[model samples]
Target: MATTFENLLYDLDAATGILTLTVNRPNKLNALNATTIAELGQAIAQARQDGAVRGILLTGSGEKAFVAGADIAELAQLSGPAAQEAAARGQAVFREFETSPKPVVAAVNGFALGGGCELAMACHIRVAAEHARFGQPEVNLGLLPGYGGTQRLVQLVGKGKALELLLTADQVKADEALRLGLANHVVP
Candidate 1:
């Protein structure tokens, strides 16, 4: 059975013991708006307490992106403390995934930029599709990755590569992501 949400599809597989959480905002390239993030936190919390769920598989709804990024429209309105609070909330929710006792794996089917990339890094493992692209393009927006992207990208890909990616705001293709150790596997 699947739990209903406005922004997510939360389904638990009894046979596999894996809870699959799909971000369902393809029109926005599955962007993480505040509502979606809150729903994700709620679903993850339920999965954590559910004995039936042994692990989690996170992904997006469409072929274009696992999650494109944070909702830029929502972002455009914030400044100072408001922006800080939003980032802090996002960070806390992502932290839950990072500290989950049950394994959380990201199925990176497409673009995982900004907060999307951070979400993938929070997972215990990331499996990318052949066309998946990863980056921290926050620099272009005059913002830094606010969801542990700096630390996790460095941990996954090494300081030199991480710095280059962060500074340049360039996207890494699937094969390159695998080479950089940002992705565990790339499937065709």
Candidate 2:
């Protein structure tokens, strides 16, 4: 069966009990735009509903990033209601992945910031490359993470660490992330 999606940047392949989902917008550093988010939500929902897919591996197209963050341009134009809707959509999509019966693994290559870090946390496991960096820098942009970051960060890394990271808005290296139990494994 062929899958339909609005964003060509995302590539989904189901095979051998694994549904491999790739964020294909390398030129944009695999940023999560609205269309990409919608497609990802649909793809993940389809995978959850499909009996053939036992596992999901989410990664980026190139070596740059798993997902840098949300599309800043799109986010830059949102008002109060529009921003709320956007956050709700992102939460719903990430929640779908989080609650899925099948396991989801994030193969984080490089920058997994803001919503990207939240996305990784929503997954069952995360495997980061040696160079991978993680953070929630939304505060720097005069905003906070709208995609379950506030809660999930606390759950994953504890209140103190979560607070520190969120307040400072600094990126953590792969080893540091692993040390804090943020990332499961670090690949060379």
Candidate 3:
């Protein structure tokens, strides 16, 4: 049976022992808002504690996005300290994938920008659909990636490419993402 915690849906595969986490915000392109992030963190913690969950597959609900980015509306209202706190919360939540004893894989079906890209980077592996797109367009908003994007992007792609992307805020398509080492695989 699948369980939903606010904006996240958690389903454990009986045969494969793989838990799938779906970010359930298609209307907003599964954007990472504060509530959604909190729900996602809770679901991940639950999966980690569940003995039946051997691994995790993370994705978004709609075909249009696997999390387009952070919720811009919520971000616009934040005070300086509040914004910092929000970024810290998102970073800690994304860190769960790295610290998880069970492997966490990202199924990058569509857009993965800003916090979305950082979230994918936290995973042990990433598989992208042919139409998937990745970027850290925080620069366009006068903000740098606040969710470990700089560090993880550098670790995945080389420092040169990471810096270029960070500075340009240019989106990378699936094939280029695979070639650049941002994604492990790209399927057509």
Please tell me which predicted candidate would have the highest lDDT against the true structure: 1
Using TM-score, give the best candidate's number.
1
Is candidate 1 or 3 superior in TM-score?
1
- Judged by whole-model lDDT over C-alpha atoms, candidate 1 comes out at 0.95
Query: Model 2 off-target regions past 4 Å?
Result: 1-15
- List runs of model 3 lying over 4 Å from the truth: none
Candidates 1 and 3 compared: the better one by lDDT is 1
Candidate 1: count of backbone clashes, pairs at least 3 residues apart or interchain: 0
Q: Write the per-residue lDDT of candidate 2 for residues 167-188, one digit (tens) a residue.
A: 9999999999999999999999
TM-score of each: 0.98, 0.94, 0.98
User: Over the stretch 1-188, how does candidate 3's per-residue lDDT look in tens digits?
Assistant: 57768888899998889999999999999999999989888988898889999999999999999989999999999999999999999999999877899999999989999999999999999999999999999999999999899999999999999999999999999999999999999987
lDDT of residue 185 for candidate 2:
99
Worst 10 residues of 1 by lDDT: 75-84
- lDDT (Cα) of model 2: 0.89
Residue-wise C-alpha lDDT for candidate 1, range 1-188, written one tens digit per residue:
78999999998999999999999999999999999999989988998899999999999999999999999999998888988998998898999999999999999999999999999999999999999999999999888999889999999999999999999999999999999999999999
